[model samples]
Target: MFTDEVVDSVSIQSLWRKSQQSSQESRGCQTRVVHSAEAEAQTVSATISCTQTEPQYQATQQLFPNHDELEPPGLKDFLQRVEDTVIRELVKNAKSHAFDGFQVNWEDHSQLVSCLHCLQHPSAHERGLHVTSVSWSCTGSVIVCAYGRIDDGDWSTEGSCVCTWNLDRRALNPKQADLVIDVPTAVTALCCHPKQPALIAGGLYSGEVVIWDTSRTQDPVLVQTGMSVDSHREPVYQVAWVPMQKKGEFGVLSASSGGRVLIWTVDSDQGRLVLNSAYALVRQQVPHSSSSSFKVSLRIRENTVTNQSTLSEMYFRLKTMLVHVLSLSLSLSGEVQIFDLGRRSLRPAATIEQGDQGQAATCLAFNCQNPHLLAVGKTDGTVGVWQLSTDLTEQSPRESAQLEQIANQVAE
Candidate 1:
């Protein structure tokens, strides 16, 4: 059986065969129409316009078919009679002094605005820090600038620094600062001490208030709030040095966006601030008189200003009426209300509807040197220096009588 299988395998191997192949060549052609890129081009333009205007009042024109027939009577005689009188009056008026020095000036004399200085800090500038606030020292010889972010809303732990320059210094450098105080966080507000030129009060983005004594050589921070329970939980927008009960000593007054205002005194021994008093602004607790037209809500946590003057102005976001605290007068919508702080009434003492109810006032300052000069900072970023009307600021003999009448309002 093995021998027969070997013979059959050799026969099958001999039968393995292959097929042959052939090759041919062919060609075809196609025609195309193409335009030339290097060509001469020409362009033509034509325009036609016509305008014709006829005499106006043609329809109302009364055709004088009989011009001589409708001639005015005694026109020559009337002219002769008034000619002498008109000439005499004209001659007399020309010699009169009523309008001799009068002139109409249609242009304003205050033309160019003066830019004093363009100060900068290289370290803060290189780090892309924005100047949040600026203040002038009491002597007016030095200016301080606080570095922070204004466009960003997110919380940042990025360190901040305050740069100061002595304008009276011979080597005043705009590219560099005379003094730089490194801070722990971004500064939101800065104010130089009204009396002390070396002291500066600042509010930070981290809801802390810091007092920096620039006169100090090593430790610039005199006192600060370090995450204490009595400290502000929200970012402080405003910080001012308010006069304390103790003579010659000042207290720190800070207002936050959370509607809380706290006052603190410097405790240098412990390097901390001691809480003196606190005030919170609440919408429900607001005394709404009947004179108020539209409702208002206390929403501004980003801006606040305080000083030692009797005049004060408050600003709210939505209300057209300026949320002001003045015993003199206030206006909402179109009515000006004169109220008393001592009396508790739902109605105002007197209402004057004919008062200025224009755009709300934001912040203001009174010149202690010049009582008439009042600088008002508006919501539109324009500061208006108003001269108080003599009739308003001037004391009148009838002021007492007017107070008595308001105290006993017989009319409802």
Candidate 2:
């Protein structure tokens, strides 16, 4: 046998060379076995080298830089790199389908208005009034329908029309409304026809529905009233115009305080317009056990002539659904129900119970491009979005399979 010191020195050098060779062959392969005899020889060599001179292990460590110390960076450099990574991630997220947010730029402030407060006419009510419902005329003029208590201890009359500065004119032409329509009771809901210009339909506190012709200055040409012997028992809460088909019959849809949805057909018989109640789409009880007395309070009070709230509500709700009226949505008890016009049935589309449940849904709107994208406003001044995608059915399986394969590969 060789001297112990010489044997140990040779073994250490052999072990280092073998390690380098194995690394060079396959850096990623972690399972290559080392011969036990070779390892023993290398250990013996290391022991002999240590005995013969100042420990070679210490010298080797000094020769090879410590990875952690060599790669240390200053605070500024580290922060800059982090910021760059964050910016890149943000850009990628914005381009991805997962990101949803509003992006718009307005140059002129006057072009928009908030409907937070309903402007007051001094002679109409002693305390003026707050707008209960509002609708936009065909010419882009605002039709503020106000309802509030007058000084006379009686609920003031309903269906008052106040025209603000015409937005189409692009100037502040604000003026007190000279035109007003006194209905049987306070108007609870308002809707404009999709095809007919200057035509408005409203549901009233007296459980009646009325249509107004803005072209005529006098009282609304009551096309059909719902207070008849066979009218909806409960007060009407919401009204919507059916999306006019590109080439088909035109109609209107109305939702009642009693959870009844009705569809009507408008026909012209020898220059005389006849509104016919055609179908009762849905007539289910409100799902929530809360008092049916729940109503959405308009943020606009009389004497506060701002259109911001109204415009924003309209922009998010009405404008979103202008593309396809096939479905109608309302949030009840934090659950969104979509009414299919074709099926005439209610379908629970989505549920958003993450936020305050007590926050009643004030308004709901749909995206123009995507019918499944809905924007909902709550009574607590919060807006939430729900995105529905049919693509999920196709992509989910493939994504799950891909993830499983990645995990399996990592395990092996």
Candidate 3:
């Protein structure tokens, strides 16, 4: 793994793999041809050849010649390499100094984006209640804000609220808000629907998930309070919308601090949200090694992060067939676990570590354009970019046929 610093942006280019190697024999020729279907298009053909020959050695009288070696690097080549190294260091330092002094120059035709408005409650503007979470609509025209406070004990909803602001307006208008929800519980997490811009999902400190429709802001459209032990045991740390497998049907996935992942389906006809299923994450144990005759006990190290709490955040990669979750622990160590959501159980398929001894991750984001790339932000103001590659086995023709038949039957 290569660890490179990224101060501005990072990107990966397309990778190409060669299917065949060049021939070992000398003086070889190869030909390749391309076929075109359209009459207007051109058909091309090419030929390539390789030639190798041994050099004939001859004795020659040298007149004060000091360079006659071909094995090691010569003096001139060594000096040139040293000079290139010095030049590289100089360029790196110069760029670092320029950025540090805020001397960056931008093109005249470039556009700059700045904040145009700010929103805050009039009565609580000065003593500002802590903003716990925020979310953006699918169209990027509205902002949803949630309020809460940090407490040693369980949180209460004395002055908590959920509000939305119109981004197209120039100023914050009290009457311009399309939705303002007053709840008796503190809102901890918020997520917007992928297809519906007006639909919103909020997770509360009371372990309840509620869905609100902006068209009718009087109250929540659907509330799953889990009044009869059907909800999460702990606070819901994160919530995300899952892409529906079937048309016109959608679901919401929530992650809690109790190592539970719950899937809730939306029922528009009944105006209700119901829990479809729940998955539990279990701690994995290392197996003992066995020899020819007896078994040997190998000492294994314990993970401090796994012993403290469960998942902190969740991201679902629709194309990769994987679910990524960040762990919440007492220590500063950050850990991410990947699970195959296609399986019945929730055992982690892989685990990745982040941060140093005292640093922790603050946020994480996956590249939608490139499913194999992930970006993580640390508490120390550093970012880590990683590229992931998965090993998938190919199935035989008979197995593939059987799977296709099963899928066809299910569709029928």
Model 3 stretches with alpha carbons more than 4 Å out: 1-113, 123-128, 151-159, 174-178, 268-270, 283-412
Residue 145 of candidate 3: its Cα lDDT? 68
Q: Give Cα-based local distance difference scores for all models.
A: 0.62, 0.46, 0.55
In model 1, residue pairs whose N, Cα or C atoms come closer than 3 Å (at least 3 residues apart or on different chains), thus clashing, are none
Q: lDDT of model 3 at residue 214?
A: 81
Stretches of candidate 2 exceeding 4 Å from the true structure: 1-120, 123-128, 139-165, 168-175, 243-249, 267-412
Error of 3 at 52 (Å): 62
TM-scores of all models? Answer: 0.48, 0.38, 0.44
lDDT of 2 by residue, 1-412 (tens): 7565533333435688789887875345477786665333333333333336659888888898676675555876888879989999989997896323222323332222112222334434442343344444443334334342222234434443322223334543223344556665565666655556567777666666667776777655647654554456565667767654547555556666454445555544432223333223222322344432322222321122333243101111232232222333445454444432222235322234424575445455443334444445443333344554442112344345655674585455
Query: What is candidate 3's local distance difference test score?
Result: 0.55
lDDT of 1 by residue, 183-280 (tens): 87888877788889999999999999999999998999888887887788888878888897789899888888887778888887888888876665
lDDT of 3 by residue, 258-366 (tens): 7666778876677666776565554342123432122122222122122333323222322122222222122246544444322223544344455455554444444
Candidate 3, run of 10 with poorest lDDT = 107-116
Cα misplacement distance, residue 275 of candidate 1 (Å): 0.6
